[model samples]
Target: MTRTGPVEIDEQTQLAARLRLVVGRLHRRIRIDGRESVPPLQLSALVTVEQHGPMRLSELARREAVSAPTMSRVLSALDEQGLVIRTPDPNDARGVQIVLSDAGAAKLAEVRSHRTALVARRLGRLDDDERRRIADALPALEALLVDED
Candidate 1:
């Protein structure tokens, strides 16, 4: 629904009621479908390294919005699993940059594939018209993220 800068209470109330329930259910289901072999923090750290690797441990921690100590523990778990490695930073001899190992990339890909497959399988059960309606809502759904920082 179109609205000026701030969404009025009535419109927002209706939208929020519908969106919270649907989005929460999908999020939980998709999360369950992903791999649980690694702990959540470790898996998230591994994916972070894979996506924006060759970055300083401190930088990664900052990007993750986590304390340096907390991120260090996450990295330690990932390192022990051979999912990520810390290389000497090119710019600073005292600093280390985190990068995803080959195995880490593979694991991340596998987890993502499982999540995608689960969602696709569920969507496939919908009738053609139902599926079409969902497809039509994709743009609006995606647009929701644009408001986020």
Candidate 2:
């Protein structure tokens, strides 16, 4: 049923849609510019482990919001690449804890440096006022990520 005269969208909804598109596109551009070696999911999982320190497979899976099987596959690939090390959880003999290897830390640093440089270069193209506008919006933008619960 297409009875389209003029579909009304509230201001907040319009802003939400635009924000989502812009953020997604910017993230893609940064990842592409970084020439990431690992796929995004694996990279994200690696970052999570690095940030949270060594954790059990279930914990990593939960933090990454991925199923255990999927996280296992990602970890297996990472282990093959020497980006992560999995060791038996001392408290739970049956479970393994994931640790980010030195190689993984180096990889994350390289990717972050490249992406930061790319964004800095792009920001340099903008005028002073334009840059200030972005800086001013940053706090509000960051607030959007705060978990309500």
Best by lDDT: 2
Clashing pairs in 2: none
TM-scores for candidates 1 onward, in order: 0.85, 0.89
Tens digits of lDDT, candidate 1, 1-149: 76555557778888889999999999887887764687777777777777775898788888788999999888888888888888898898998888988988888888888888998999999999999999999999899889656
Off by over 4 Å in 1: 1-8, 147-149
lDDT of each: 0.84, 0.90
Runs of candidate 2 with Cα error greater than 4 angstroms are 1-9
Q: What is the lDDT of residue 115 in candidate 2?
A: 87
lDDT tens per residue, model 2, 36-128 = 788999999989999999998889889888999998899999999999999889998898889999999998898888889999998999999
RMSD of 1: 2.8
Cα error, candidate 1, residue 46 (Å): 2.4
